[model samples]
Target: MPENPTSQPVPFRGGGFNPRPRALIGLAVMVVLIAVWETGCRTGIIHPLVLPAPSEAATAFMELVDSGLLWTHLGASLSRLVIGWTAGTILGITVGFAIGLFSLARAGMVPLVAAIFPIPKIALLPLFIIWFGIGEGSKVATILFGTFFPTVVATYGGVDNVDRGLIRMGQSFGLSWVSIVRKIILPGALPAILPGFRISAAIAIVLLVAAEMIGAEFGVGAYILMAGSLMAMDQLIAGVAILSTIGLTVSWIIGRAEKALLRWRV
Candidate 1:
């Protein structure tokens, strides 16, 4: 007699993916932390000089807003970030694809990228200033340079990691080279590439701040530097908060892009 199929144990699926509860919980924890911090500051348990309360930072942020300095600083930083990051990402993607696909590019660019990537990008700021000058050119170049190597590494690595089976299958089907790359390789490599964007974006922001701190008259980094020099913890914290917010915003945008682009995976 055959055994009943129904007698076999079914595999368990994990809990359903509901993000709302987790998000709400995270928000609650942040609120609680802020409340505790505020209470501590008010009770003199935490020194204001060392760590300004969230309220104090908020007040400082508002003052910057009223003085019209916030936009000036923010606009300068945003301009540099957008231009530099965009240029780096585009060039990196192009070079990375070449390195991944062509033997000559891999031989030449791989060694160059590997060499430059290990160097601290901030240390190169003075060199860029000399090359591009002390104006916006140097600052943007710093961010671009910082962003480029990571993007190149990520893109080419992603391409290399694409399954050989898929490429062979495409070739067997008599697909053209361009068609195979467009359809099979790019889609396969996208999962890795998106994460790379996140990393490169973060690096770009750091380099942007570093570049601004060196010679920039108006930028978030410059504002933070001034605040620190004056020992104004509140304003400094506000500058930091702004940077944090920008990071979160970039992450959110990238997340949305991933969702849209990788819908095929789901």
Candidate 2:
């Protein structure tokens, strides 16, 4: 019997990782959660002291905006986040590349990184305050310290994961070491590095908030701390919402970057 061509498998298309349906489902879940939360508050099933209603949180957010306090807090947090994260990421990439490429650096740095990476960065906040002083410096240092280790681990791991066959192929084509690294290794390592950015960015934000809550007076963390002390659940929830917004914005930015930089993959 002859095989029928029409019965051949159609190559699967439009069935993998569709963002629209995923996004819609996520949005639906969020809407349902919010609706349930609001209903619970209205029905007195949830204590306002424990968790403010969404509407109350929204009102508090609006008041902060109208009072110009939002920008003040946002500006301080953004400055610390950018400076600390950038500094840490740059250093991590540099050191990670060195460690990945050179046995000497690996011998010296890998154990040190392993030693430090597992230590709770928040636990060092007091030490940072003592060293850098109770100011922007300390806050930034806390975030920087928290962000650095993960990035280092990520970068070197990325470099290590690059295919040896490709490196040999580059060398066979008479590519210089530097040229091969730039053209092949870096590009190959980028996918790993970009994901590391997301992790480091999140760590930076959390550390930033912790550091701010300690001694800073005009950051989102500080605002939350004050609200908690005063039992202002609405303002505290508003501050939390701001943090969520910041996380979402950062994730979106990283996603855009991945799309732009990793276009060659597709």
Candidate 3:
């Protein structure tokens, strides 16, 4: 009897081709779009002021780099995001653990957090400006406000859902409360908590741009606004492209860090 083809085992494909082909296809698509855009601009079908070609944007970006202005603005924005997100994450973790562990803290803080979380951060941007001035302080405060609520909610849920049995196992081993939390609770809750950090990183970047638009002297947001006012469409687009790249890079790095640090988790 002839063997059935369906009964034959199919050979497994290697992982090497998985990402490479997809990346190549994406690159090809982008090249085609850029070529079309450049052709349109050169033919005067698309006004340079309205939609600058990729070449024009690239030239503007190179000029900014040569003038050393791009790095300076990027540094300012990066500093604000790092400081604000760090502060927000620390507070979120502390408050989340407190509420998850103690009924008293939950009863006291949950309502307050709920009330504030619904308010738009942009609506309070004016108040932050008034309180912190139009300096780095205001920008940082705005990013922190934008990031804090999401971080708190995600982390609190993670901690609250920690398995009680694991905690008891630690306790039975004569572990102190701190030791039990460090060994059992945090590890158990890490999968949930890590996603919150990723969310906060994205929120921090977005809010940093919004904050910088409000009279900031240096930063990506301010640069985009300045370019727009000057009718420098290429520069404006270049600034936006830079910000997008930064956000992507930060997200990828943090995800890799999470995988490495929480290797023990499910």
Candidate 4:
């Protein structure tokens, strides 16, 4: 049979929505913005007192480095961030797995998570201080609490969303319960869980700042608070830049983790 003359092969339209990595584009955008900001400050389009130049912020950052206080402030924040975020992540994963794997745990914990999740964690800082005192304990507790709920949500949500077909297939193969959970469920849930980690990390930083601003003496938040109180915009911006750097660093770490752990997807 002859093919119809008007019939043309359909153009391929199955391009996957995979993102291409053009990291330079992002870097260029940031550079352009900073250039504009610096030019504005130089030309008086923006006031110095209102917003210090990026150069000024850099100078202040250098001052911190020279004075050796950068490490002091940074070390304190890192310790808290690491401790609190790690603790929260561990517990969240545990609780989330519990909720996902067992019916009784789900019935008991889901409502509890829902009820407590909506409350502002920053608001609880005062209560934490009252309970744990105006020290590292309160600050750590604030970050921990802030991180925990979202992680729990992410963990259980990931688990629930895992393909039951895969689970059934494993069972049909006579895989043990622990083996199924370890090999199938854990990997399936990681995509969700890792991003949840990103969210929890961001929350932990915010809570850390808030917690530090109240009573701590040596953290990025404390540094920013002091700079603001003294009307030192450069130093304030420097402190903020520090926090941003920390966030970027955390994001990069997580990205590396995703690449390492999710190689099977590719």
Candidate 5:
């Protein structure tokens, strides 16, 4: 591996924009921010009424754990999130594929989706409550409705963006339409669809919190609402932290899925 000054080879420039992990950097940033926040609160530079210290939030979080309400709230939220997100994603993908592959579906549904996608899904919570009642049904329906439209847009967009040349080559080679779609189109579309999952998951979480705040009893959103009503800023922050943890967990799960399913790119 000696460097030859007289006969130098060209440097390799084919390496794409590969991302490397910087976990420690992110951790350090969070630690520093918390330290500053705690210091400010202790020194009276930051008012407790305005922003609670990180330690106060931690104490509230531990209190929930000690009372065993943490599990109850987390379990309820996770159940709704899973059921709603799974159902919406499956349905969106099915309809998306149809729209992407067919002229009639594309013509009819695209306009409908465009019209509905812009409306804030949270605004329809009252209607859902009226239809499904102020129960688990309403909450799940809220999350499902919020998640469905974005997923449809992302999925169909992904399919549309797939290379037509590859599809034509498949056809010229006498490959079946099903085979072309399964092999070439599906994989090509995954890069977009997976990120769509991320968007839908975030929407689902937001909708879950909004819906639960209405009439739900055993959820992180309900906990946050109660804490806010009682002026318990620390507990409110703790609830927010719990939501952040859920977001992080969902993101990690999606990253793992991408790693497993998109190995061809590696």
Candidate 6:
């Protein structure tokens, strides 16, 4: 005899798909790709010198770990990223606020920012090298230059979109310009500036590597360059993979911070 339709237990739908199962599937896909690449390399279908297989990269990673060289390169790269990104974000937010708050500031800075926006920062690499020398200063300056403009533009847009009524309400209370900006303008602009930083963080990291590659004694970028020059394909691939992972991780952290700080936006 068949059971009544209404008598069956309700299936769990709250999980949609189980998180563990979804994670396992993702891992399976990564494993499959790695396996395919490994097979291709072993069979000579893919040139190992040109594109090292996952296994080769894994071996190189272990070698670097054992030699204690990976940490040195990683540290140098991270330090530069921190210094450069901080400078860029601070400058961008300050200028953005000025432009958003005053018509005169907007009229002057907006045109200047717009004019420079189209210029490739890489073109200024030579200038930075000339002024700062091919050292840590130049490297950090290059990254700061690369990340600054986008952040400033995004932040200015955010501030501009803030509701004027709120500003008027604050003014009705006889709040000073500084007080209103601190209490209202910044909070309103937070949402726009958050995404800008997320993008800028990634760009800053990339610029750090690029700067290091051009002129640095130690950095992940320099490691990759040295490996590539020596035909150490596995090491080169490992260095690049590490750099990419770091960039993604930094972006994720910034996004999480943004969500936390902008919780009131909801």
Superposition error at 131 for model 6 (Å): 0.7
Locate the minimum summed-lDDT window of 10 residues in model 4.
1-10
**Native-to-model Cα distance after best TM-score fit, residue 28 in candidate 2, in Å:** 1.1
Candidate 6 lDDT trough over 10 residues, lowest sum: 14-23
lDDT of 6 by residue, 92-209 (tens): 8998988988899999999999998777777788899999988888888888887889888989999999889999999999999898999999898888998998888878877887
Better of 1 and 4 by lDDT: 4
Q: 1-266, model 4: which lDDT tens digit per residue?
A: 27666767889999889999886999999999999999999999999998999999999999999999999999999999999999999999999999999999999999999999999998888899999999899999988898999999999999999999999999999999999999999999999999999999999999889889998889999999999999999999999999999999999999999999988885
Q: Name the best candidate (by lDDT).
A: 4
Query: What TM-score does structure 3 among the candidates reach?
Result: 0.86
Question: What TM-score would each prediction reach against the true structure?
Answer: 0.90, 0.91, 0.86, 0.92, 0.90, 0.87
For candidate 3, the 10 contiguous residues with the lowest summed lDDT are 14-23
Q: List the residue pairs that clash in candidate 2.
A: none
Residue 170 in model 4: shift from native, Å?
A: 2.6
lDDT of 2 by residue, 110-184 (tens): 999999999989999899989999999899888888889999999999999999999999999999999988999
Considering every candidate listed, which one attains the maximal TM-score? Answer: 4
Candidate 4 or 5, higher TM-score? 4
Clashing pairs in 4: none
After superposition, candidate 3 runs with Cα above 4 Å error? 1-36, 39-45
**Candidate 6 similarity to native, TM-score:** 0.87
lDDT of 1 by residue, 62-165 (tens): 99999999999999999999999999999998999999999999999998998999998899889999999998999999889888899899999999999999
lDDT of each: 0.93, 0.93, 0.87, 0.95, 0.93, 0.87
Clashes by residue pair, model 5:
none
Task: Please report the TM-score between candidate 1 and the true structure.
Answer: 0.90
Q: Single out the weakest 10-residue window by summed lDDT for candidate 5.
A: 1-10
**Model 3 C-alpha lDDT per residue in residues 194-224, reported as the tens digit of each score:** 8888888988888888898898889999999
How well does candidate 4 match the true structure, expressed as C-alpha RMSD? 3.6
